[model samples]
Target: MSKKLLATGLAVLTLGSAPMALSHLVKDEAMQSYRQSYFTLIAMNFGPMTAMVKGDMPWDDAKMLALAEDFAAVASVDVARAFGPGSDKGTTRAKPEIWENTEDFLEKYAALQTASKGLLAAAQSGDRAAIGGAIKETGGACKACHDEYKAKDYLY
Candidate 1:
């Protein structure tokens, strides 16, 4: 092919692919932000419960119930949606293994959702021991995912 023809073809190829690449970049950024916000919300609610259960904070049944409800509501969101392809590359601590081992990652996510429900039920029961056990179970569920799929460090 002529030099001019080669240049034209290269330009066309770049133009055609640029939009798709940009689209994925934008999507990945949004998903990363969404997942991070979800975890932040969960921590805000879960932290107090853990503190109360551990005696780090004074135990209040009403506050426990409220926090558990918020935790469950936040956990109910489909976190798998934020783990879509390309999201593993952005400003996120989500490990690339989440994409490689999708089934396992989702199972862990589901476990968290189930544990959150258990927590809320325990809170409603107004039994301190039950609430403590539920909080432990919920933390275990969170640890299962973090152990496998969450990275300790993120790339800037």
Candidate 2:
């Protein structure tokens, strides 16, 4: 091949790959932010539910159901992409084990989603006891993953 042709090919290849590489990097950063925001949203909904369940706050069925719905919405998100490769870098507390043992991590994530659904169902029943039980189970599911996957210093 002529030197000119080879140089042109190389330039095209490098330029073409640059966007893909940059897109992947952007996606990784976005995923990290998204993961953090998602957990924050979960906490925002869960904290109040927990207080109500613990009797620290008065029970309000309407409010509980709304909160449960919010939690379920966040929990039901497609988390598979949120933990994408390289997301463990930056200000994230996700243990490296999450990427290494992705199957187990995904299973735990699914468990939390299931628990969130259970909580939603329980909330729909308008039974404080049932809702409380569901909340406990949901919290347990969250703790299970946090215990195994999150960095120790990050735990609350």
Query: What is the Cα-based TM-score of model 2?
Result: 0.78
lDDT of each residue in 1-156, candidate 2, tens digit only: 999999999999999899765553345368776777788889999999999989999989899999999999999898778888777787678888898999999999999999999999999999888998999999999999999898865422
Off by over 4 Å in 2: 1-28, 154-156
lDDT of each: 0.90, 0.87
Compared with the true structure, the alpha-carbon lDDT of candidate 2 equals 0.87
RMSD of each: 15.0, 13.4
Error of 2 at 68 (Å): 0.7
